[model samples]
Target: MSEKIALGNWGEELVAKKARCPKCKNAKTLKKLTQNFKCADLICDFCGFVAQVKTSSTNDINTLPNSILGAAWGPQKERMDAGIYTSLFVVLRSKSDKNYSIFFLPSELQVPEMFVAREPLSGNAKRAGWQGFLIDTTLVADRFVRLI
Candidate 1:
């Protein structure tokens, strides 16, 4: 039997199938677990093959021309206060090198900071107020997928 794991409120689920290991080619032995609710860390137990799962369910967001530049999350207390469990600050980079950092709720994209241009944020800048480059998440439309 396969294990059905709920990937939080992203409306995405991981159906752990008994498939061949990508490295060893062993049959029906792959298992996966996430380190966070964001499902950022998906690992296979057999040959230690790591795979990234797409979290977006919409084509619009998936088709966005923008790219992720940076990301951050509120403190636990702040997250609970906002009535959002897993929140993030997503920094988006356009093709023209224009960067904007937006406060990303688990359900939607909010609080965008506008600037003509943005750099990679120095350590001092980050300490002051910048979250720097998030550069990991690829599913843009997943921001709009919400659970209420």
Candidate 2:
């Protein structure tokens, strides 16, 4: 098979391909999971590292320049522990009105767990104080430039 393949799901096509493992730097072990959440999950069998990509449901993608798009997380503690940061965040563009969506990628977008005070947070998330990572979009612009 080729290095990349388009997997269809829910009548939508998922562009899937192998990804590099951030932990072990293994090129072959990381592949995008086409099932489950419909986005992408970078899972590395070489080091047991896994991360998810979440697509925004909202149509209004025109966000303020260099701002956070949103936040998300897996309910399982195991996944959280495996992640570099317990919380995750997505960033917006620096300046643009176009509808550009970003994913809350792990490994690359990790934050210190302590900084996230979940106990003081209150929202729809029943998990605790704060659920997702608090990130500044400016710092992550370079990392997600391809997506932008």
Per-model clash counts, in order, read 4, 5
Candidate with top lDDT is 2
* Candidate 1: stretches off by over 4 Å: 1-12, 18-20, 37-40, 60-148
Model 1 Cα shift for residue 44 (angstroms): 1.4
Backbone clashes counted, model 2: 5
The global C-alpha lDDT for each of the candidates, from Candidate 1 onward, is 0.34, 0.40
Model 2 superposed RMSD (Cα): 9.0
lDDT for 141 in candidate 2 is 45
Q: How well is each residue in 1-148 modelled by candidate 1, as lDDT tens digits?
A: 2121231212122213422444476655545454343313334577665433323222333243244422233332244356542233222223343332222333233232211123434767636654333333444445542211
Give the clashing pairs for model 1: 69-134, 70-133, 70-134, 71-134
